[model samples]
Target: MARNPERRNALLDAAIEVLTDEGARGLTFRAVDARAGTPTGTASNYFADRDALLAQTATRVNERMVPDPEHVASLMAAEPSRELIVHLMRDLVRRMTAERSGYLAMLELRLEATRRPALREELNRTVREQYDGNLQFHLASGLPGDADAMRVLYLAMTGLLVEHFTLPEMLSDTPEALDELVAVTVERIFPAA
Candidate 1:
């Protein structure tokens, strides 16, 4: 039987919904099949196994979060603006908060990937892509181009985001707290300009 791309996408979408809504512990072939409105055997036929489904799901999540090559190139060509950087950071935080379950699912996948070499490799590749894209954006925005500086900025931004998700009060105490944090972080990282 021919594999339907539409069916595959439907399954993938359902997988994401299940993962986000129920976490990794709740994700199962049966649940996904039900969510996709497909036959019980269809998911297994398409995914072969849970690991395969997870790997594909991780790839999909990364693709959705990070900018693509063309988008990155365009960002690199544009003039660096603090407003743009802050907006990006704010949007990422908002998305993370809104998709809390999805973020938790990704964290679970990261833990599982530690014991699975193939999954680990796929995650590492995604991380590299994210780092590269972020580096390009930071550089284009006139931040220091040194790897160390970029790493520090990335780490700080990630830490802030984690806090934003886990401790919403820390950021939501005031309307401008997140913006202030971003501004401070940016100025500290790119002091010269």
Candidate 2:
């Protein structure tokens, strides 16, 4: 197996783009190599098989989607309140929207997981870990939310993102719609503090 970190990352990144544009069915070693601008068989050298490529692509997409530490720290500097919760969620929507391809790639991975047990287990574990970490962060931040509240917020925000990305026409086109949605979600989830 190739041990070049940069090359591996490039291949994985290219895999993400392929997943975004082509979905799981269209993903192939040739497609990845072409997308990465590498020689034929280059992706196979880095990835053992298509499943490996898909698994690693999921990890890479998760890496790209996480919020920056600096940005999180900056937001944490302010007092936690319902309004702050709304702000945090809005920031999340903005970040996810900005990294549109990565988010879409993740969704593709989720869909692919349905047919692959190994991939399904891997995704389930990763999602659970993420949820646990998010719950911890919410508790530590004093963000005016409990575990139940956090769970609800996560589901609501995920639904909003899915609609925003996959079916934009289903929601209002007005610029304020997203903000209002986030605000209302937070308001309903967290009591006045």
Candidate 3:
């Protein structure tokens, strides 16, 4: 891998755009180069293979989507109460809605991972790392839940986010209704205090 960090990031962003718009099958070095408006073969200069390109694209999408530590800490400042959890869920879903393209790219990566062992291994590792990190954060913050609770919360949030981003009206009539849905989901999963 050539280490042109700036150029590599530009290529990764372009890859995400391609994935978001055309799905995994459409993600090609030439597509990325064209999307980035760079010279032909520019993406190939940085990526050794399609697997490497997809791996970097996934990493970049994850980086773009994760919230900053400070914001997460502020959200947790009120302690791990039901209401606080609901607010966090709302914010998370809202953030996913805003970053719909990135989320779509991630979905594309996940679907493509099913057929590529190397990509599957890497994506699985990344997913486990995120799950572990969330569990650790919950424990450190004194959240009232264990691994199973976290799993349920994770699934619930994933479902909510997918619905919000893909089929918004199915979840609610308006944005306020979506907030209520988040509140209800959190309350159900976390148990009211």
Where does the lowest 10-residue lDDT sum fall in candidate 1?
71-80
Question: Model 3: runs farther than 4 Å from truth?
Answer: none
Candidate 3 per-residue lDDT over residues 103-158, each given as its tens digit? 99999999999999999888898878887898888777877777788899999888
The lDDT for every candidate, in the order shown, is 0.73, 0.90, 0.88
Candidate 2's TM-score reads 0.97
Q: How far is 100's C-alpha from truth in model 1 (Å)?
A: 4.9
Candidates ranked by lDDT: 2, 3, 1
User: Least accurate stretch of 10 residues (summed lDDT) in model 3?
Assistant: 79-88
In model 1, residue pairs whose N, Cα or C atoms come closer than 3 Å (at least 3 residues apart or on different chains), thus clashing, are none
- Model 1, residue 31: C-alpha shift (Å): 1.5
lDDT for 38 (candidate 1) = 88
Q: How would you encode candidate 2's per-residue C-alpha lDDT over 61-88 as one tens digit per residue?
A: 8888888999999998999888889889
TM-score of model 3 (CA atoms) = 0.95
List residue ranges in candidate 1 displaced over 4 A.
Answer: 68-78, 81-84, 95-101, 140-145, 171-175
lDDT for predicted candidate 3 compared with the true structure: 0.88
Ranking according to TM-score, highest score first = 2, 3, 1
TM-score for candidate 1, residues paired by index: 0.78
